[model samples]
Target: MMKATPESMTDADGLEMDRCFSTRGGVAYVGLRDRWPWYTKRRSASWPFAELRVADDKIVISSMFGKYAVTRDDVASISRFGRIPALYDGFKFVIRGDYEAVVFWALWGPPVRAAFVRHGWEIVG
Candidate 1:
C-alpha cells in the first residue's frame, strides 16, 4: 500500500477521472464562490475556501489550497461531526483510505445527503 505522510500527501485529484469514471450529469455542489465558505478554520477542508461537488457516483471538493474526491467504493461510513457545532455541524463520509470529508447539512445539505442515499451508502449517525 502507498503510505502518505502529511507533508507529502496531497488531496485527491479528479482532473483525470473523466477517463476512468463517467463524469457526466447528476452534478450538485455548494459553497461560496467568493472565497469564504460561510465559516473559516477547518482541517479537512481546503485552506482559504472550498467547494463541494457531487456528480454521477462521485464527490469532488476543491479550493485555492487543494482538491479531494472519492467514488462510492471508497466510502465506508457517514456520521455527525460536531467539532465546531451548528455552522460546522455536518455529516462526514469516512473513506476506505483513511480519508474523510465534512459536508454541512445546512449548505444544500438535503441534496448532499440525498446523493449518498441514492447510492444506498451509509449514515452511521
Candidate 2:
C-alpha cells in the first residue's frame, strides 16, 4: 500500500491540505464532500485522515485518526448530497441515502439540534 505524505494530501477543492500541527490536545473534525462520509477529523500527526481501499467485496473506508474502518456492509446508507442553507442560518440538513443508516454532524448544540429536528431529521443521542 502507498502511504500518504504531507505533500500528497489534497482537499476536495484539489488544493493541497493545510499541514498544521496540532498544538493542543484534541481532534480537528471535518466532513468530506463527494464521498460516503458524514463526519471526519484529524488529530495528532500519526492519526489517519481518510483512505479508501477495497476489502472483501465492498469498498472500505480506512480512517486514519483511529482504528476506525467502515465497509459497505457496515454502512446503512450513503449520502450523495447535503445542504445547510445559508438563509436558514443555524439550521442544517444532512441527507443520507441508506435505509436505517444515520447521519451525524459534529456540532452538538441545542440550537443546531432543534434546527435539525425542525427539518424532520431525527437527532440521535
Candidate 3:
C-alpha cells in the first residue's frame, strides 16, 4: 500500500494542494473530493472529505476517522446514485465482503467513474 505524502498529493487539476487531509474536531478525511458546499450545509457535520486513490488492483480511501482499501475482487458493483445535473450526482461502491458501501458525491461523477473503469472495475449502474 502506498501512502500519500505532501510532495505526492495532487488535486484533480494535477496541481499539488499541499494538504492531503481534512480534519475536524480531531478527525481527518481523505477522498476523491470533499463534500459539496450545499451538501455540507444540509448535513450539519463538517467532516466528510474523502481522498480516493486507485492502486494496482484496489481502491483506497484514506480519512482521519478511518481508512479502507477495496480490491477489484472485493467489489460487487459500482452504480450512479442519481441522474446527472442533479444537486449532486454521486457514485456508489458496493463491496462483496462485510464492508459497507461507499458513496462519493459531486456535481460531476465522470472523472472518478472513468478512473474506476480504467482499472477494470465493474459498474452495474
Most TM-score-accurate candidate: 3
| Cα deviation of 116, candidate 3, in Å | 1.5
lDDT of 3 by residue, 9-90 (tens): 7755343455222222111222223435311111211224555665446565555445555676777766775455734555
lDDT (Cα, tens digit) per residue for candidate 2, span 1-125: 99989678854433344431111111232444555664454232212343322222232222334423234345443332233343212212222442222222222234544433443434344
- What would you estimate as the lDDT of candidate 2? 0.33
List clashing residue pairs in candidate 2: 48-64, 48-65, 49-64, 77-98
CA lDDT, every prediction? 0.46, 0.33, 0.51
Least well predicted 10-residue stretch by lDDT in candidate 1: 19-28
Better of 1 and 2 by lDDT: 1
RMSD of each: 12.8, 14.3, 10.5
Cα misplacement distance, residue 37 of candidate 3 (Å): 25
Instruction: Kindly report which residue stretches of model 2 are placed more than 4 angstroms away from their true locations once superposed.
Output: 1-49, 82-125
For model 1, residues 1-125, the per-residue Cα lDDT tens digits are 99755455333553333222121111112221235553333444322255555555666655544555667787765665443443333655556755234443333344545655665556565
